[model samples]
Target chain A: MKITILYFARIKEVVNYSSEDVVLPEEVETIIALKSWLSGRGATWQKLFDGSGVVRAAINHELVDDMATFDEGDEVAFFPPVTGG
Target chain B: MYLKVSVQPGDFDVGAELQQLRAATPQAGALVNFVGLVRDVSTDGQVSEMVIEHYPGMTEKALQQIAQQAMQRWPLLGIRLIHRVGSLTAQAQIVLVAATSLHRQAAFEACAFMMDYLKTEAPFWKKEVGDFGQHWVEARASDEQAKQQWKLPK
Candidate 1:
């Protein structure tokens, strides 16, 4: 399935990219699976998804847990916890 | 109910926003407003400026959801939530949240509820630039605890 991924705040600074569209492998169906798959990209990805820090995810503009599943054309976002008032 | 949610890079006029809300909901007897300003001091050192970043589409959606939840939780007649992005200097206004209701209690509680939810749930992040250098502001555990207090009893 093809999906769009967005990085915000410090995550964007670390990844050096704001957004990307990619076709997900069959094994990457859930948010945790996607995180694990992306961590294979490089050191920065590993550092982010290695569970050292709290990273929040949202699917289609709604915050979700790691077990939440997304489908094709969905918009997924990853960022550190929010600090806005 | 009247609801306005905006995510912009420019500053907002709090007085004008409040006037508009009051005009729209003439029946409301209480109008509560909260303005958040960028502090000049931080834990590291004197802060010069803050750079705020937010997810374009999601920020507005999350704010609207928060406002809607506030409306449901209280008898609110109108709500206005505006958050500014981009680089902002110390003492500049960063956010405005206003709630109007027929009574003071509902308006006061709703205003605080919306702010608590916005702090933890909104996608905006702040990067503080000070004498110590730039660093992303960490989310406060106190904010999470404040939001949790609003949870309905199971």
Candidate 2:
């Protein structure tokens, strides 16, 4: 499956890229699984995704948990906790 | 009910917004509005500026949902919610939430409820620039606790 991943706030700074499009591995189905797959890329990815609760995910614009599933062409966003009023 | 939600980079006029809300719902006996400003001080030092970023498409949807919830919970006749993005200086207006109702209680409660939810649920993030350099603002536990009061029984 192919997906567009978005990084926001501090995560964007750490990731050094605002957004990207990539084809996912067959084994990556859930948000957690996707994070683990990305984390395997390098030290920066591991620091951001390997730790639990350090980041939050949203599928197609709505906030979701790690267990949330995504399909092809989904827009997945990862960011820190919101601090807006 | 009359509802207006805007996520923009430009500042809004409070008087003009209130006038429009009043004109839209002439029968409303109460109008309550809240304006949030960028604080000049932070834990690190004096805050020189604040940069706000948001998920564009999701932000509008989230604000609308919060306004709808306020309408459902209270007898609101109209609601106006505006949040400004981009770089802002201290004392600049950042947000405006206003509600009109038949009574003051309903207006007051709905306005407060909307703000509480917006604080925690909205996708916008704030970064403060100060003497200690720039840093992303952290979400407060109190904001999460504040929203618990309005939870409806399933």
Candidate 3:
């Protein structure tokens, strides 16, 4: 399945792209799986996807927990936890 | 109910907004206001400037939902929420929430509740531009805990 990932804050700086398309492995079903898959991309990807990282995930525009599942073409945004008032 | 969410490279008058709300609702005997300001520190380093970004359609909807929640929980006679996005200098206001009711406790509680929700739940994001370049401030555990205090039935 294909998904678009969004980057914000330091995550955006490390990723160097606001959003992108990627083909997911069959094992990548939930947001946790998706992050795990992203972590395997390389060192830079791993830094932002590390489980302890402050990244927040959203399935489409609705914020989702790491266990939330994703469908094809789902919009996933990853960023530092929001700090706006 | 009055809401204004915009991305302007400018400032606003909270006093004026309060006056407008007061004039618009004669029955309101109390006004609760929350003013958000830009600070001068970032986790990265000393912050000199901050830039705010937001999802246009989504931000307004999220804010209105907060106001609606306050109305449902309290006897608010009027509600006004305004949030500004874009480059902001230190000490500049970012958002304001004013809730008016027949009693001070209702107005104050609802206003505080709405602000707490916005700090953690809203879609707006701010990038702190400091000596070390820019980085978005991570969500604070304190905020989540503060919000949780209100979760019990009241």
The lDDT per prediction is 0.94, 0.94, 0.79
The residue-by-residue lDDT of candidate 2 on A38-61, one tens digit each, is: 998999999898775469899998
Model 3 TM-score on a 0 to 1 scale: 0.85
Clashing pairs in 3: none
Retained true contacts (fraction), each candidate: 0.84, 0.76, 0.65
Q: Write the per-residue lDDT of candidate 3 for residues A38-72, one digit (tens) a residue.
A: 88879988877776666777776777798999899
Summed over model 2, clashes come to 0
What local lDDT does model 3 show for residue B109?
Answer: 96
Pick the winner on lDDT between candidates 1 and 2: 1
Q: Candidate 2 at A49: error in angstroms?
A: 1.7
Ranking the candidates on TM-score from highest down gives 1, 2, 3
Candidate 1 fraction of reference contacts recovered: 0.84
lDDT-wise, the better of 2 and 3 is 2
Off by over 4 Å in 1: none
Report the number of the highest-DockQ candidate: 1
lDDT of model 3, residue A31: 85
* Cα lDDT of model 2 by residue, B54-149, tens digit: 998999998999999999989899999999999999889999999999999999999999999999888999999988899999999899899998
